[model samples]
Structure formats: C-alpha cells, structure tokens
Target: MPKSVVSLWLLVSACTTSPSHSQSWDFELRVVARGLQVPWSVLWGPDGWLWCTERPGRISRIHPETGEKRILLSAIEGVYARGEAGLLGMALHPRFTDSPFVAVAYTVYSGFVELRIVRYRYDASRDTLLDPQILLANIRVGNIHAGCRFLNLPDGTLLLSVGEGGIPALAQDLSSLSGKVLRIHWDGKVPADNPIPGSFVWAWGLRNSQGLALGRGGLIYGSEHGATTDDEINLLQPGRNYGWPSVEGYCDTPPEEQFCRDSNVVEPLYAWTPTVAPCGLAYYDSALTHLPQFRHSLLLATLKGSTLYQLRLSQDGGRIEEVNAYPLGLGRLRDVLVTPDGRVFVSTSNRDGRGAPQPDDDKIVELVPKNQGIEDTEERSLLRLWCQERQLWVEARAPVTVRVITVCGHVLVEWRGLPQQRWSLQSLAAGWYGVIAWDGVRREFSPIVVP
Candidate 1:
C-alpha cells in the first residue's frame, strides 16, 4: 500500500475554514454521560434509553436523564478490537418492540481481521442480549477504512456501507463485498430489488464510508472519509458507482473526468477539502419546537474537525443549501443522534488513541434549546473527580471505598472517602488513571487525567 493510503487510516487532517454561515440556533450543551472509551455508535432507543457501543464490543444502555449506564454485553463474542477495527455499528429492528432484534457489525479474527454482521435478541426481561445469530460473515476488513455504518430502512431491509478494506482495487471488483453499500433482508437474504441479482451489493465504488442516513422521499445519504481531501456526502442511488480510487470528489481532473465519462461515476452531493473525517450522519425533520432553523437538515459528526456540522437541505431535500459548524469543545465526536422530538446527542471519541484525553473524556453530550428548561438531575456518581490548579477534587454520593488505579489496573492510591474530598496531584505524572468506587453492593468506574 502507498504511504498516503496508510496515512489516511492513521492521520486525520483538521479542517480550518469557517462554515458557510454562523450558528443560527440558540442551543446549550449538557453532559449526558461521561468516561466512555471510544464510543463508536449511539442510538436513541424507542424505549427512551440511549443505546451505545464502545470499540471494545461492550453494548450498553444509558439512561438519558440520570446518566446511568447499564452494560448488556461485556464483550461481544469473537470480536477483534485493535486500532480502528472492532464492534463498529448497530441498528435496532424497525419494529423493535415486536421483533426485539438488534443487529451489529464487528470485525472478527478469522485468521485475519474480517467483518461480520450478527443479530441478537434483546431480552428485556433478562436484562441481557441473548441468542446470537450470524446474519452475514466473511467480509474483508482492515485496521482502518472498515466502513461499517448501518441504516434500517422502513421497508424492513438493512443497508450497510462497507469500506474497501484498504485495497483500492477491491472497490471496483463487483464480486467483492468491500467498497459497497449492501442491501439485505433482516434474515440476511439479498433484497429482491437489489441491482445485482443474488448479491447483497446495492451500490459500489466507495472508500471508507462511515455514515448512513435516510432523507426525504426515502433517499439514502452517506458520509465518507476520503484519503486526504474531498471527504464526501453522497446521495446514494441503487446501481450507481461512486468513483472511489478513480475519482476523489468530482470529475474535475482530466484523468478523473475521463474515468467519470467512461464509468458513469456519480459525483458527490457535497465535498469537503482538507478532510474532516466525517463519521455518523442523522437526518432531522422532526416536530421539535426548538431549533426550528434545523428543521429539514442533516446533522453530521466529525472526528478530525471535532465539530458537529449541520447541512441545511434544500426544500426538496435533494441539495445542500448551507453548511454550518457547531463546536461544543468536546474533541473528536464519533456519532450524532437526533430523536423524534428533535433532541440532539453526540458521543465523543477523544480516548481513541488519537486525541488528548482530558479528565472525564469521551462523554455523550446533548444539545437543547437555550429557552428550554433543563431539569437539574442530581448526578449519582459512586466516585467522580475533576482537576483544577493541580489539585484532584473527588466526590462521592455515599460512603464507599475509592481506589485510584493506573490504566493497567495497578492500584496507586486506595482509601475510604465520603462526599466531597480533595487529593493533591502535584506529585503525579501526566497520564491516564482510573478511579473506582465500591459501595459493597455495586461498583462504579470513571477516568481521570493528570496534567
């Protein structure tokens, strides 16, 4: 592989240009949950909980109000989480209440890292995920460029975006599953209307598309991470080629123009130079009273840019009229979720080995209208702490034994503490540490950083 291809998987270029317009909506950000390790996906469940997946394959449901996270599965079976490869995307069945099926895509080690899609039964009564069923398996995957975002369409079909698995040649190969948007029934059968007969591929020629969304008139929209320049938001169509290795953004270059004319490659709806590393995408046309200006728009979360981008759609939803950027100061946002009532939530990815992890990094933050009254839900943390002036301030809701441990699970300081306490951190080195609190009945964990 070329050095540039490897750099695309490791390094991300930050976007510095200002958005087309200023932030028009008056919104305040609230921290919903904290101390997550590389949260890869987040879904606003119909049952009113936030379903999230970490890169290490832990499936969790977080209470949107109380910030309590309940782990359903500690580690998915046979998951290979190294670098960018791991349990990536998830989707609840369209009729989740009736079907109760949760579908997930993960990179599993089959000699080499390969991709697999599995379905599990969400057993609410048992408070666990049960009965794993392998829906699709044996797709090629790489450390990076393993595009695996999912969208459960209304017609009871699943749409998955597969990356080229770091091989540029595989993108144009019709027989390969890489670099394609695949359509399959819930049972893993090829959709009847798929362009390729007996094949799950709905569209081809893409390089590491990480986001998928459904727009007006049942149109599919996708966000892709380009190699260096030309991160794209594509209007996906059935049987269309997106021109991955041949063309980066448009048919502007002479060679690309020749390929575009010969291959009939569809250009992107919008492209960003300097590469923003666009990840999760959400379409917002809800009945929410707040942020009416955001109506009929698409919310995009970016890793390198570390900003939530709002692309206002045209009246017919076929064109992007304007692009605006909202920086919440949370670094490397991985996923964005928009609820039916227009509630917006984003998951941070600062701890993903590429960012500077601050104290209590990798949190899920919510965006609310400034006029809306946010209820002050007293956070019940077994142990929580923050740093200020080189002093570590620790707090506890109840009597508990707190242990300050290193990232390798080595205990550095162990003590019994009450509510509101302080410890000097001037002697400690700059690194990551874990603070654990045990109340004899339950245990809680949080991450702290020393600077």
Candidate 2:
C-alpha cells in the first residue's frame, strides 16, 4: 500500500478488569520502502535518511520522503543468518558530524554460532560505511532466541541486549554474556562506572530481549520474549536480575517467588500471556498535535500479535497508567521508530520464515497523521532541534523564531531570525520544556526533557 490513509482507534485498557476506552487516531500507514529480506532494524539517521538492516547481511539507506533505497553495504562477512539469527540492530553516533560512526549487532558463525557488535565508520564523502571494528564478539548464540538490540547513552556509552540463545541456564549465569544487557564504552572497553567492575553486564536474566529504548531521565526500557507465556516490557536497572528460567514474569508461583526473593529479581513493568513477541520498543513523549495520546508512552511492536502496544507512563515516568493497542494490517512488525517531530515508522517481518507475505513481502511503513503537513514546509525540512551539554540547540534553513517555553507557558529562551543558535539551560531546573519554532504563519512543537 502506498500513501494509504486509514482512520483507526486506539484500544485503551487500564487492566484486565477495567472497561476498554477508545481514542480515535487519524493515522495513515503507508509503505516507506519494500521488498527486503527481513528488515530487522529501522533507524532514523542524522543525515536525514532511514537506515535499515536486512537480516541477510545488508544495510540500506532509504530516502524518507521518496521511498528510494541505496545499499550502503552488502553480504557482510561471516554472517550466519538462519532461524531468528541475523544482522539485527543498528545505531548511529550521537555526534555524527564530528565523530562519524555506525554500530551494528549480528550473528556470526565461527565454528559455533555467536553474536557480535561491530562499529563501522561512516564515510560521508563516499556515502558509505567502512572500516569494520569489532567491538564485542564470540558471545554464545543459537539459531533461535539470539537477542540483539542497541541503545546509546548520552555519556557516550552503548547498551546491548543479548538473548539466552535457547539456553535457559545461561540467563542465571553472571559470568556468561548471554541473557544480559551489557554497557560498554565506545572503544570496546567496559565503562569505569559500570555496575560490575571489568564486566559489561549491566543487567541479567533475560530470555530474548529484542527491544531497547530510553525514556525520561535516561531510564532504560526493554521488551523480551517469554517461552510460552509472559512476554514482558521491563524497566532495566543496573545489576538488577529478571528471573527467566525460574520465573517467567511476576513472582506469581511459589518457586518463582522464592527465586525472586533470593535473586534480587526485578519484576517486569507489564507482562502479557499467550506471548505477543514484542520486538521493538520506542519511547514517545513528543507534544506533536496529531499523536497527543502517545505522549509519555512506550510504543512496542509485536511479531506474533501484529500490534502496536502503547504503555502510557505516569507523570513521574515510573508507572504504567494505561495500556493501548493499535492493530496495523502489516503482519509481524519487527521494529518501530519515532522521529524527532512526530512521525512513527515500523518495519514488517512477514518474510522472516513466518506469517503470510503480501506482494511487498517485507516493508517499512510510515504512520502519517491525517492533519500532518500543516506546518511550514521549510521548518519541517530544515529545523533541527536537540539537547546536548546542558544546552538547547536549534538550526534552521530559513529565518525562524525559536522559543524554549516551560510547561506552564512561560517563555524562557527566545531567539528571533537566526539560522543557528544554542542556549545554555544550566541555570534552569531539570524538567520537561517545550521547544517551539515558527516562521510567521506555521509553527512546530517538540517536547524535550532537560536532564
């Protein structure tokens, strides 16, 4: 489907006992790009392109507006892709202009199957990624349940989630790299401040975590697949344990309750029975007009259920206040991406040895709100706003007025008719602020948390 606009309602439920509520969202899910061998990861690149990783060892850059794709690299050396194993996660450097680097995680076969994290240099002059630097390698992996997802911290550290590789016992082994979330420095060394000295394991006891995202205050969130039941979305903490083999989700069973008390186990924020196979997780708190219902929520994409699960967070970003489900016709959603503005995108995994594939078997679909395109075209295309170094930065192609307004409608920082600007918020208190940029007639809004 190309440029398909469909009206849909989000199914909201507080709990199993609570009655359901419906919120209408005028979202138009359309094909961004198509025909890929299991597009595992779809990341929005700093260079204004959609970067995608195909399971069969290929990375392509897709034009977001035109849906045109160009292969950056292909037939990655030593990739052993099979059932549930392949090139999976991709992440770009936070400072892409200064330090151009791209990181990827994939399964490789060296005698035995193993998972690996490699960093590639983005050569912008040639528009290609080169110079493969293997950061971490030789982690145990199997044909199935080989988890791989990446999240980059503001402090220049990287977090990766590893599956147990169908070996349930490995989840409890702290010495083993399998079934753990590892935090490592950019140069492949363990961070000095990591929970465990000389160890990259930040958290442990996961069956197959495929989704990783960052929420407010740098809180880490992950989604994992359970064996038969209890697919979970957990708030990951340093050195915390999530009972996998002994306990599926919460400590509902006697044995699991005992294991939890002894093992420092942290229960999942939310768990689902009949396993939805949640693959990709994204944190959304943008104040975009179209998707107001998704603010302060975690967007989860599932494989088996083919649904987008939105878990709304509380005011303090601690609890899940509500759970909402939106069904997209695309089968087996592998990954989801939320842009800085307000766009949401998901990659289809129908061709991944399961589900019924459509004419465009595997595709990256974009969710465009019905009332989109009302903003200034130039502001939408050229404005780049972000937070770094306790400062708010804004760049625009044309002259525009930028304002840093508090949640209570107080304008703190204002810049008029500047192509580029940066304002220090060091004196301001830590909380959420609205960044607004406008050119005379049309305005844009981006909600950001000042940490």
Candidate 3:
C-alpha cells in the first residue's frame, strides 16, 4: 500500500475552509467510551441515547452525560465472526419512537455463511431487545469483502450497501446480491417501484462499499474501497452502474471508457490514487452544528488512512466545493455520527487485527467546536443544562432569555431570568427539546432529552 497525501482548501471561504479559518470553534477531542472489540456502526438514538454496534456481535448503549457503558445485547448468536465478517451494521426504524425497531446486519451460518438483516423490538423500559425477526437473508458474504451499512430514507425505505465479497465478477452479476446496493421496504419487502422488477437492487457494480450517506436535495453519496488505488467517493444514482472490475475510479483508460459507455456506468465524484479505505459517511445539515461551513459538508471516516475528511458540497449538493482532511492521530476510524447538539463522535477500529491498538484498544471520541462560557463542566457554580433533569440551572453571569424549542422547530417556552435561576421544563412534553440562550447578541444552544 502506498502512502496517501494530505489535502485541504486553505483559500476557500470561511464556511468551507478547515478549522484553521474558524476561531469560533473551540476544537476538543476526548474519549467517551473505550475497550471495544471492533465497533462498527454508531448513531444517536431517537431518545438522545448513544448506541453502537460491535463487530464482535453485540450492541452497547452509552450514557451521553457520564459516558457510562451498558451492554444492550451481550452477543448475537449465529453471528459468524471471521476476517472482516461479523455483526457489522445497525440502524433504527425511521419512526423509532413509535416503531421501536432496531435492525442489525450480521454474517449468519447454518449450512453456509450468509449475510442477513435482522430486526428486533427495543423495549426501552426493560432496556432489552425483543422479538428478533430476519427481514432480509441469504445474501452471499465473504471474509474480506462484506460491505454492510444501511440508511433509512425519509419515506421508510431502507438503502443497504452490499459488498462484492471479494469476487470481482459478482459486482456485475446482478443475479447475485454481492457488490450492489439494495433498496427495500421497512418490512423487508421490495419496493413496488423497484428499479428492477421483483429485485431489491437499486444499483449494481459496486466494489466493497464501506460508507453510505444521504445528502441534501435527494443526493446520495457512497465511499467505495477500490481494488488498490481507486478508492472512490461516488454520487449514487438510481439504477446506475458503478464500473468496478471494468473501471476502477474514472474512465481514464480506453477499455474503461468502453465499459462505461457499454454499461452506462457512472463515474465517481472524487477518488483517491492511493486507497484511503474510506469507511463511514455523514452529512452535516443542522444549525446545531454551530459551524456554518460544515453545515453542508460530508464527514467521512477512513481506516487505512486514519483521517476524517470533510467534503464541502455545493448549496444544491450537486457539486463538491472543497476537500479538507483531519488527521485523527489515533487509529483507524470505523464510524462517525453527529449529535443534535453539533458534537461529532467517531469510533476507532484499531483492535480489528489491522492497526496497533492503544491502551484501551478502541474508543468513541467527540469532536467539538470552540465553545464559550461554562468552562468547567464538572463545576456547578456556573450553569448547566441537564437533559435528563429537564432543567437549566444558572449561576448569574448575565441576564439571558432561555428558549426551549422542539426538534420540530416549535418554541415551547421562553423565560427571561437572571444567571442564578432555574428554568423548569414542566410545560414542555416528554421528548428531546433544543434549548437556546440569548444574552443580547450572543446565543448558545443545548440539547435536552426529557424522560
């Protein structure tokens, strides 16, 4: 493997430039959770709880406040764990508050090793998963090439990325589920308007696609692991083919051009000459992020390169404005997710038999912006917003108005109080609410999850 070079747009406008351009961001990196056997997928749950899937076949729930870890599922039996094969991806039902369904992708074996997507009912009261049901099954899986990450669309449709499973020919062979992206209903049924009749394949010819993300304006992006030097960031078009064995990155060669023309293959938006092994893709489209420049960018995690790349997209999300890479200095990063509070978290993959693990091996890290006020989080002398308590206790710094807003953008309460006062959230319903404070001109927002 060749070494990859670092690149960033230093001349771009402040919104899209690297952290060096922003003094508003008080960048902070800290471990939230540690000691994991290859954590693969992570996401902030609907209840504002942090959840993670371990590749060794278990799910963990971490306390957002204290970083206390709890094992939701000790082990998913029948999960065939091997080289690059194990319990991999996880996603929550689109309406998780009502549906309460948790889905996971794992390699299962009876007579043969098969990739399966299973759903379970999460019992919040009991803190356990129940009623395991296999939604989709029998997709061929291999040790090395098992791309399995899923993202739920707005309308409850699930988009799943399937790896070529180390077989170059399987990518082009639509008859097999390997090396393709699949789309299906939440109930594991093929959509009535599937690109191919009776098949869940939305697009074919993908090499092991490790990262899948949806962007603004219906734009979908995927990070693909190339054969050697053609790791790609692709614009996933419906029913379009991404030339894999035939064409690596772009149609730079004559044969690749012929293949592109013959198969109607779509070229990647951007690609790396030396494979960076991009694994996770996240789109920042929230005002809570605080950083305006990262609002429309794609945050990607890499394994071999061990970098976090932010690809700033155009307003319409059709074109790329610039690329900025941040070195983790830690080990390989497997997955990344941004919370409703604008704090970004990444899971390390150092213990996956590839990179050298640190003392604790793997961890969940938080990336934050330059913050103001309340310097010491542990000290109660200043102010604090306890999500679980649904109270903002202040220590009288300045006269500020506290506004409690819902996730749906509705203001529930607005109370003007002194710094050393308490604002009770008794008026707001039980749910996660966004609370913002404004002192004349300066504004700060925090997240609160009501029990």
Candidate 4:
C-alpha cells in the first residue's frame, strides 16, 4: 500500500511454456478498428473518444463501444511518410473543452526532414482541425531515433522528450535542440524558470527517449533506447545529463564513472540488457478513477521486445518496486493507453516495414479482463458484486469481509471494509469462483464465471 514499497518490487515473468501462462489468455484481446495504416499514437480523449494518429499524416476519432471510426483530420500536406517519420505524438490542450486546441508532432519533408511541433484548433461543428500554428520547428528529423513524446504538465507547460535524432553527439551538445527534453509554454515560448538561460532544454544527454512519465511523489521517469544493451529507465531531473553516448545504462565502469563524476551525470533507475526498445510510457496514479489495482504503477510498450510492461512504483515514486512483463504475440507495439474507466488499449506498429504484418497489421486492440459484469444481490440493494467483462466490482455501504474463493474451496483474495472495490481478473484462469461478503449480521455469496 505504501508508495516506496511498490517501486522496489520487481517481477520477471517470461512468456514461455508454463501452466500458469494460460491465465494471460483470460484477457480478451479485441480489435476495435482495422485497415489502419500504421497507427502510431493513441490516447483517450477528453471528449470520451479514442483519438488516434496514423503514420500517414491523418487523425481519427474512434468510438470505444461501436468501433465506429471517423477520420477527423487528414490531407496533411508536407508530411514525410518515411521510416520513423510522419505524424508522431499528439496531446489535447488541458482546457480542451474551451480552447479546443491540440498539439501534434510530425515530420515535414522538403529538401530535408524536420520534426515540427504545432498547435491546431478544432472546429467541433465541422469535425475538422483548423488554424495550424507551428510551435517548435528547429528540430532536425532523422530516419530513426526521432524521439518526440509529449507530457502535458499541470503547470500549463508541456514537457517534450526529444531524441538525439540518430546522432549520438547531438545528445551532448547543448546548442542543438536534439536529444533533450524541452519544456516550453503552450504558446511556444521558453519558460523563464528553465535550467539553462534562454534555452528550452530541461534535460539533455538522451538517446531516443520515447517515454516520459511523471508519477507520484514528484518523480520524473523516462525511457530510452540503447545501442545493443543498456536500454534504460531514468529518474529525470532538470538540467541533468542522462549519459547517452559516453555512458549507457549505469556509470559503473571506471572510465564512465570518471565522466559521470566530472559531468554530474545521473544514472537510470532500471535498464534492460537485451534492449526491449521501450516506447509509450504511462504512469498510473490517483488520477485514474477506474483501475485501482493499476494505481502507483507505470506501464510501457516495447517495440522489438513486443511486450507490455507494468511496473509498480513505490510510495515515494523514487524507486521501482516490481515489474510485470506481459508478452504480446502481436507484432511491434507502438503505444499503450489507459482510460479513466480502466480500459487499456494498444496500437500495433507491425505495418512499419520492419515488422511482419498480421491480417489487421496496424489495428488498435483493447485488452479486456475476463469477468466483465458484476452480479447483483437481493439481500441488500447497496451491497453489490458486479463484473464487467474482466473487472469485478464490489460495492458495499458498510464494513464487510470480502473473500474471493475458487470453486475448489481455495481462497484467492480477501479484503475488509471497502466502500467500493475493484479487482482485475487478468491473472485468473477461466473457472467458476465465488465472492462472499460477510457482515456481522448476514452472509452473501456471489458467483463469478470466467470464460
């Protein structure tokens, strides 16, 4: 329950032959939309829709329930649809309902490719994007290692993670805009409180950092790709160097230690040796209203590794307590997003040339828990056990002892005094189960079936 405890927890579960492996199948992988041309970025919009960006320079809004897709913005001119180029990340304005502004990062091809971050206003009536204004346009774009992920901070400024643009030296160069996390105001001006004067660079020395996450306890986390080994996750700080070319994962080597001490370089909290190619990063905090089990956790989508990683963070948010790696048989995942209601969605990058495509090469898939709906009881209307798809919800007005038991008389979980409780059946196998809620005066049984 403590924040620091979750950060230090680590669980390494490989997707290999194991009798318990079948429990992962309990999560129903449903394709929400198909025929997508390399869908790159996905987010749950403020308008109660799933907003998506295809690498071919188009924006779409998808209905979560009906799977009805609408091409909201298209006909994007001057877009470079090359390897690792085209439209990348997008973020809705914090005040989206009133301002209706959206920020997008894309590669503009002319004589050379350049990564540009721009803001666009949406016309709700026409369902179109209008009034495009370029915010940051000096970033050089590379065919690979073009890291541009967005993190809209609460203080009206946006934190942008910039890769070294395939050039290792650029990460160490303070003058270059590449290979740094830049903080800029919504109107494209550098914040006065920037670590460096007249510069937007908040942190530098990063190589292809694709994921920037701010978790509980004011800890800033980032994920970067390393050459062969040392794929890293860092505790990012302003004006800090992440040791990209000179140092990979940790500053453990003698020579690397010398540079680290001389340069005041910071080490990563965690790193992967074989290189998972971690991309989309999302931190689960109290902000998520639906998925309580996922709270105080960080989720990352990996490309080459083809896995969804869930890390339980500590109460201090300074450490990683545990990591649960869920392998996705689907080809190269590009993005991972969670909704306010606890629904998780991921987009495949299989159509991105490097990966072999499936029938729906670049589709958006939803991961649903097995037990979907909750069961109701007549004993007390306020006392309810509801399961929706794969999530079990228990609603009780007073203190009660809740026990989840298997059909074979094995108790799986037990909790006490929850006004409302939620449990994800992701790890549970398909079988019959019972949920018993015992108050001082009476006992109630709720049957659960997972198929």
Candidate 5:
C-alpha cells in the first residue's frame, strides 16, 4: 500500500474496537438550555457560544458549560408558526469574528406567510442586534412545504434551500426561487459561477428540504420531505435539477415524460420510505475517537422517527448505508451538530405540536462518551494531531526524531527549532502517523490521525 493509505489504515485500527455486545451505548445527556418554544436550529458561534432559534421569531444564546440561557433577539412580527412555517434556519458569517453578521430565515404573515432570509449585525457591547438587512425576499410560503435551510460553505458562499411553495409546479419553474437551492455571495449577490448568470438558482426541483450540509470533498447533501412516500437525501451539484414533482424519488417515469428530460437532473444518493422527517445534518470527520464507527459518517436528525440515523459513507463516495439508527427518546429532534470538542449537540422541537413532551424534552442535549475504564488497560489510541500546537500524545518512550521518517525509513516532515512551539500542519493529509514529544531528556512516541 501507499504510505498515505497505510497510515490511514493504521490510524483506523488504533482508534476502533470491536462492537460491544451490549446494545446500550455509553453516553451522558445534558440539557444545555430549556424554556425554548419550538427551537428550530442550534449552532456554535465563532466566540464558542451556542446559539439557537425559536420558532416564534426569537434568537437565544446558551452557555455550554453552565447551561445558562440568554435571549438575544425577540418580538419580531410575522412569524407564521403553524405546522412547518416559522423561524427556521440561521447561519453566521464565514468571518463571524470580524463581521459579526448573522443570517436568519423566517416566515412572514403577509396573507400567505412568505419565507424570507435576512441578515442582522450583532452588537457585542450592547448584546443586541444593530442593523438588519434583507438579503433574499418574496419567497412564497404556505402551511406546508416552507423549506428553509442555510449553509455557509467553506469557500465563503451562501447556499439556501427554498421549498416548492406548496405547489409542486413551482419546483420546475426556472423563474421562481421556490423549490430551488439558491447560491449567493455574502452580500446577496448572485455567484458568477452559478448555472445561470444573474440567477440565484443553483439547483432546482426540490420539495420541502429542511436539512442542508456539506460533506467531505465539498459535496453538498440535503434531506427532503416526501408527499406520501420516498423522502430523499440528494447529492447536490451545481446547475443540476433534482426532479421534484416531475419525478418523486428516482426516475419512475419514461424518458419523454420526465420534467427535466434534457435539463440535467440529478438523482438522490439515498431515499427513505414512510418518511423519517429528517431535519438537521452534520458530517463527522473522525475527530471523536470515542465513537470510531461514526468517524467520517453523516449524522442525520429525524423528527418523525425521533431517532438519530448514522449513515456510513463508502470511500468511493457513490454509496451510503444506514449503519446505525438509535432513538433519542427525546421529543422531536430538529437539529444535530458536532461541537468543536467532538461532542454531539441536538435540538428538540417538542413544542411544535409533534412529539410526546417530557419535562426537559424541548431543550438542547449534549452527548458525552462515558470512559468505561478501558483507558487503563487498552492502549491509548491517537485520535488526531493538531499540528498548530505541535503537541504529541506519546504512549511510550521513543526517539523524538521518528515522526520525520517514512515507513521505508526516509524523512518526510522535519523540524528543528524552539521546543514546544506551535506549528500549523496546513500541508498534511487526513491520516494517521506517529508523533514524538520530548521533555528535556525523556522522549515518547504517540500515534495520531490527521483528520
């Protein structure tokens, strides 16, 4: 095997273990916030704060450690909270620390409850919103099919999902913004590389897709609501139509009768029957060694199923299998997010008139892996190497110069400078390797995966 592949395999072997015979997984749940009326989405802010949106047009922040909650924005009018329409999606600016801008998607009460995406500036000193800017406007909305999801791509582009506006035909219409995935710049300008010039419609023919997430290799995936059967998870490509209304799950119609027969429609990666009502999605990239099976998998949140579905992706990127699906026992999960420290955070939407509510059911819950005393006997697995700090997790005593050598005993990465200094690993691939740390005269070798 190539050196990189061998390194990845070694890292996977070190981090993973045989599945436990016990069905119950070891994890602790903590209620991070409560008294939230139909919390829609939960996101980690740039300042390490957890922020959430309430369905009735309110934005709140929660202290992750203390579970303290503070209401930041409220009392905004025109939030249609019947069924699926309300404060739905939120996304922070890519450069949130410097820009302090937040984008929100909400439903208006203008006869038909139009969905709109607006941007607001956060006033840190006053702890409130300073200026509100309407970025996207005139999105048709109804009691159902108000698809509102936001994603701030790594390339600093904004991607928003708009539903079919309660009319299936709207998804096929190129002129309408409804039933389409729109891509725009930060300032609401259409991207120059969009499928059509002067058009925010990057891809079309989507139903009520509520979940949008970017995966490895810059692939975009979305979860959509089905009419009766065939809820879908689609692989998003620029300028590709998803064949909504015209075709439901896959191409079930004849070639001549298809809606986008010659318009380059894309098929879904995975589809579910009987509907899971998937809401939020996040990609896990092997950062958490505790749940090694979930590494590089897509964690999907479901409302109707009331369970978290873990889809293990194939290395070839063409197939995805449902590896694990477990019930949260919480009421109506709306969103699932992986924190910076490898903890899983999920938001519940019990107040939305869906699930059986309990005392702390409608709050955010964090999942922490329980250390089951295996660390004492089992070998310490190197989870990942953060080269920015130049820190190593040494398991045993070894030469400090071993990290610079290849498997064939050739030098790859070398450094000779101040001890314990931080060094960024921008030139490294996602894999496993050995790290050697020295404390004066003593040295130790540790394995690490760079995911």
Candidate 6:
C-alpha cells in the first residue's frame, strides 16, 4: 500500500473508542510535590526527571515514577523571592544528552531586583552542578513588569522575554533590553542574523510578556499582561516592533494617530478582555480521536481565570479562534506543559499569595485520557457507548462505527469505513457487543456492551 494509504489504515485502527457512554469525566488529581515556596516553572529535564523552580531561588528535581524529590541548586546570587520577582523560567538544552546544560531566568539583588539569565552544567555521574555561566544580566527590574521567560527555538537559538521596565516608557525605547524578546546563540553569544547585529535584542515593544512558545512553521507566540483589560497574544517576529504602551490589542487609534500611526508596528493575532492573565503556553500533539478541531490549537494557562484556554487555529495558521476554555478551578494556574507521551501537566500558583487557595492547591496535575486503563465493570448500567469503538470516549459530533459478533468466528455487523457514520443505538436492547472500526486497511476491536 502507498504511504498515505498506510497512514489511513493506522488512523482507523488507532482511533478506537469506548461504548457510547455519557458520564462526567472524573479527573484524577495527583499532587506531584508540595512545600514549594511559590513554584514558577516546570520543565522535563535530562534523565527522565522533572525539574521545577521555586521563587526563593531553589531548583528541585522530582522523579515522576518514584515521587522522589531532590534539591539541585541554591544560593548562587540575587534571587528576589518577593511577589513575582524570583527564579522564573528554565529550559534544558536540546542536545542535553551530550551537553547537559540548563538555562535559568531569575531576579538578582543588585540593590534592586534585576532579571538575569545563567547556564549550568549538570554532572550526572556525581549528581551535582559543575560550571555556572552567567549568560545575560542587567535587565531592568521593578515590583512588577519583570517579564522573564526563556525558550529554545527549533533552530537552536535561545529566545528570552523581557518585560517593560517599571517605567512604561522603556517599552518604546529601542536601546533598553526591557520590554523585548532577545535571541541569542546557545553559548550566550549574539546571533549574527539578529535584527541588530552585535546586539542580543531580537524584537522590541512588549509590555510584560509572561509566556512564550514556538509553534508550527517556526512561529513564535507570546502571551502578554495587559494593564487593566486587553490581554493579548502576538506572533513574534525578529526585528519587528509590537505596539505596547502606544496601543493595546488591535489598533484603537487611527492610522494618523501619534503612537498607532507607526506602520512598522505589528498587531496581535488575538486579544482577550477582563484579562485572563495568561501565563505559560503549549501546543497539543496527541493521538486522541476527539481533538480534530484542536490539532494545532494553543493551550494557554490563565492565572486570573484559573482556566486552560484552547485557541483553535485556521488550517493555514493565519487566524485563531477561541474554541473552548476549561476551568481548572485550581487557583492561579501558572504553567502548562505537555509531556512527550501526550500527558498534559499544569503547575498552579495559588501559594503565590495571589488567589484563593484550596486544600491541595499549588501542585502539578496530570490529565489522563478518558477511557484508557479505566474499568467500568462495577457500573455497567451507567456506562453507555460514547463512541462506536469501545476504547474511545464520547465527544461532540465525533464519527463512530460499531460491529457485533458471536463467540465463534462469524460475520456480524461489520460497519467498516465511515463515510457518513452515525451510530445511535440508545433505543436498542441491552446486550454484549464487539465493536470494530476500519479505516480502509486495518481494523481495531473493542469489547463493549449496552445495559
């Protein structure tokens, strides 16, 4: 078979579903760790461990399998743990197997809290930190507006987010590192292809961007903190200026207006009102069958709303639509990440003294897919076929196909490929059924029943 035909077959066999069942999803909330004083960011580190940063300038490594926590680093220099100023962002090197380097963004006490970036080597054999290299420093600081997040771009360049200094005017100043995104080589050297040669600055005119993620087509997207309203998400381009203090969201001022008239300024792709206080962002790439509309959608973590906002993108990736928002109800979600195995992990910031706290708040939670590894034998009558396949869960308008068979090898209701597939057997009598789905090549079987 051709490659496309093979892919179609895999899709058919992999898109297994459970019986058409209707039940509220019960999320199994597991606390990864606690006693963390204002944990900011979490990243998967080398050697299958998850590394997390505490605002008071400490790094902790948590073993996902064993629930073992180890303190990695502490007391290098200048970590202001007051309010939002503390150890902020971290990213492991792409070639971590060989390099074993980790980058961190934090606030240092230089009379005033100043944002700084540093790189450290993790000695796996000795289980200790070896060399510490201060990559970038002297970022303007304030009680607020210290935009400190770092991400490694797909092209091996490191991207850093700098917030507008305490002064809003710094956002418009080209000379200041504040209120800009800086791109640099892995060794902390300025890239030659940077918009300004010999300068670490990549793009300017940002207010207080909190989250950064590189998505499809190498597009960099950032979520910004708005003053009162007009929280925005922008497509980050190197050397381009995004109107910050000048204009918020889409241009409300006219073309000839003073700040808005700058034709060189770029506009945001999407903006929200009442301020979601967007934090970390991640793109979902999973084999879940109910996620057709969310294939390339951006998962945004909101602190103010305590929800995960899913923004759906157009096919060509030029436009974005706010498809759905799921409330975590966990109080001040700070960072959201998807693991390599397609499990969604989110970090909460309720302990940061910002939001109302829950009993078991301020910990990481993993979201598991609905039907996998879960048994419903005890509540058989409560279970209905949510999908034609017995392994998948029900979602809105998803295609489902079912097959019925006997104990022996015999032909049964083999509803193979779904051209306009719709299986509504709610009125049918209750009995055991074997469901199978075919995508033109291979078949997947799931045992289900209607009671």
User: What TM-score fits each model?
Assistant: 0.79, 0.79, 0.77, 0.77, 0.75, 0.75
Which regions in candidate 4 have their CA more than 4 angstroms from the true location?
1-26, 286-293, 374-451
Check candidate 3 and list the clashing pairs.
Answer: 15-293, 25-370, 26-369, 26-370, 163-179, 396-419, 396-420
lDDT of 2 by residue, 116-168 (tens): 99999988778788999999999998999898999999898989999999999
How does each model score on lDDT? 0.80, 0.80, 0.76, 0.75, 0.71, 0.68
Residue 334 in candidate 2 has what lDDT? 95
Clashes of each: 0, 0, 7, 29, 1, 17
Over 1-451, each residue of candidate 1 has an lDDT whose tens digit, in order, gives 1100000000011311222454543665667787898889999898999999999899999988778889999998789988789999999998989999999999988887799999999999988899999889989979878879999888899999999889988889999999999998888889878999999999999999999999878989999989989999999999999999999998899999999999989999899997888999999984556567678899999986456889989888889989986644456889999887878888988888887665777788787765457542235446555555546666776888887666444568887867665555456676645566767644455544454
lDDT digits (tens) for residues 43-129 of candidate 5: 988777898898888898888766777778975666777888889899989898888898999888776768888889998887787
Worst 10 residues of 4 by lDDT: 1-10
Local accuracy of candidate 4 as per-residue lDDT tens digits, 1-451 = 1100000001112311223312233353556777688777888888788999998899999987667888888757888878888888888888888889889888886566788999999898998899999999969758887877888787878898887778899999999889999999889999999999999899999999888777776677888989999998888899999888999899989999999999999998888887888888888775664545567788888887456788877778887777776655455788888776667888888888877664546777776654454222243432465555545456775578876666433568877876665545456676655565667543444445555
Q: What TM-score, to 2 decimals, does candidate 4 have? A: 0.77
Task: Report the lDDT of model 1 for residue 392.
Answer: 64
Candidate 1 accuracy as lDDT: 0.80
lDDT of 5: 0.71
> What CA root-mean-square deviation does each model show from the true structure?
10.6, 16.0, 15.3, 12.9, 16.4, 13.6
Q: Report the lDDT of model 4 for residue 265.
A: 99
| Model 3, residue 334: C-alpha shift (Å) | 0.4
CA error at residue 355 for candidate 1, angstroms: 1.3
